[model samples]
Each structure stands twice: as C-alpha cells, then as structure tokens.
Target: MTAVALVLLAADFVTKQIALTHFSGSDPTEALGGLLRFTLVFNSGGAFSIGEGEAWFFTTVKIVVVVAMLVVSPRIRTPVWAVSFGLVIAGAAGNLVDRLFRAPSPLQGRVVDWIQLPHWPVFNLADCGVVCGSALVMWASMRGIRLNGTRESDAPAEAGATERTAEGRDR
Candidate 1:
C-alpha cells in the first residue's frame, strides 16, 4: 500500500511538472480531436473551481485527511482497504503539495490542472486517483465488506470466538 501511494504521488508530481513546463504558456493542446485536451489552469478552489478563493480551507482539509489516514493505516487489515486508502492519501498529498508550496503563498497556492474532456471540468491525475479510490471504498462498504477482510456474513461466526454465554463462559 505504501508503495502504491508513493508511485501515485510520484506520477502525479511528474505529470504536473510536465504540464507546467510544456503547457503553461500555450493554448489548449488537443490530445483527441474535440474530445480531450490539455489546458493549463491554476485552480484556487474545490472541484470545477468552486469556492475559488478558499485555498486555505482546502489545505486544512487535506492536512486533516492525510494525518487521519496515516493514523489509521497501521490497523488496515485487508489489501483492499489498504489500496483504497492509499490512493486517497496519495491524491490528497499530491494536491496538498501544490497548496503548500506551488505559488501565491503558503496554504494559498493554486493547484495546476490541465487534463480536459468534452463537456467536463478540467482536472488532473490527483483528482482521478481521489475519485477512483473513493468509489472503491464506497463499493466495498455497500457490499458489506469490512476493512479487516471479513464479510458481514462471516462476522457472526468470527465473533462467537469472543462471545460469552449466559453461563459466563466463552461460547
């Protein structure tokens, strides 16, 4: 999981650097005709540029998320949970880097977003990682999968090991 997170963070960092170097002074570069393009944008807000001046608030949120994930990661008992959380943390950290040091000022730096799609908001690799990771977490929870690698159906039997009977003895 740590490896996955590191890889994702590295990838996002490299790609953003490339975008900054190559696309910063140019018009939109089309990757696919009328479908995909790379257009440099410095966003100071949330998704789709909402709340465009709230960089400090967003930075605070990212810090909380990263710290919470770090605190919880050691207890992750399943590969699935690890991967899901890793991706999320990687995504958060990627953008957090920008918010902390990229431009403007500390906790107010703008995120560099470039990838664009037809009729969709411009976004970047970090956003992709965050959305995909969150979806996986939601799917796992919906299917009654626990973070400890146990299904809900199996929990009763597992709990029996620690359960006590009315006689005050382990079942």
Candidate 2:
C-alpha cells in the first residue's frame, strides 16, 4: 500500500512538472487534434474552475481532508478499500505539496493543471488518481466490503478470549 501511494505521488509530481515545463508560455495545444491537449492553467481554487480566487481556503480544506482520510483509511478492512484510500491520499498529497511550495506563495500556491479531454475539465495526474480512488471506495462500500485490519475470524477469537477472561475472573 505504501509503495502504491509513493508511486502515485511520484507520478503525479513528475507529470505536473512536465506540464509546467512544456506549456509554460504557450496556448493549449491538442496533441490529438481535439481529443487530447496539453494545456497550462493555474487553478487557485477547486474543480472545474469553481472558487477561482481562493487558494488558502482550498489548501486548508485539503489538509483537513487528508487528515480525515488517514484516520479513516486504516479502519477499512478490504484491500480494495485500502488501495483506493491510498490512491486518494497520494493524489491529495501531491496537490498539497504544490499548494504549500510550488510558487507565488505558501499555502496560496496554484495547482498546475493540464491534460484536457473532450468536454471534460482540465486536470492533472493527481486529480485522476483521486477521482479513480474515490469511485473505487464508493463501489466497495456499496458492495458491503470492509477495508480495515480486522479479519473475519478475529471476532470469534475475541469472543473466546473474553470467555476465558470471564472464567478466570470467577475463580
């Protein structure tokens, strides 16, 4: 899980760097002629251009969300849920890094978003991971999957241990 998280974080960072470098001072170009485009835009806010004038608010929000996710992620019993949480965390971490240290200001840093698709919002790799992970977690939860450390047998063992403890206490 840690490995996956690291990979996703690294990939997101690298791709963002590439986007920043490649499209620094040029108009967004469609590499596939309207299918895909490498566009350079600074998102000082949230998804799809909303909250376009606030960066600090979004940074604080991300921090709170990441912390919450970390606390809840470990309690998820299923591997799928864990991985999905990991993906979301990694992606959030990548963007958080940008928000903290990219440029212009601390915690007021803009996210460098590129990679446009037809009729979709312009986004980067981290956003992709977050969205993908969010969908997976939602699906897993809908199917009644637990994504925590507790195993199915743990309950029975715990019950047995409690019985033993009760018996010992009565003696």
What root-mean-square deviation over C-alphas does model 2 reach? 6.8
Score candidate 1 by lDDT.
0.89
Q: Residues 32-98, candidate 1, lDDT per residue (tens digit)?
A: 6768889899999988998899999999999999899899888789888898898999999999999
List, residue by residue over 35-128, the lDDT tens digit for candidate 2: 8888888888888978986888888988987899888765666678778888888988888898999778999898988988989888888888
Clashing pairs in 1: none
TM-score for each model: 0.88, 0.81
Candidate 1, superposed: residue stretches over 4 Å from native: 157-171
**lDDT (C-alpha) at residue 40 in model 1:** 92
User: Candidate 1: worst 10 consecutive residues by lDDT?
Assistant: 162-171
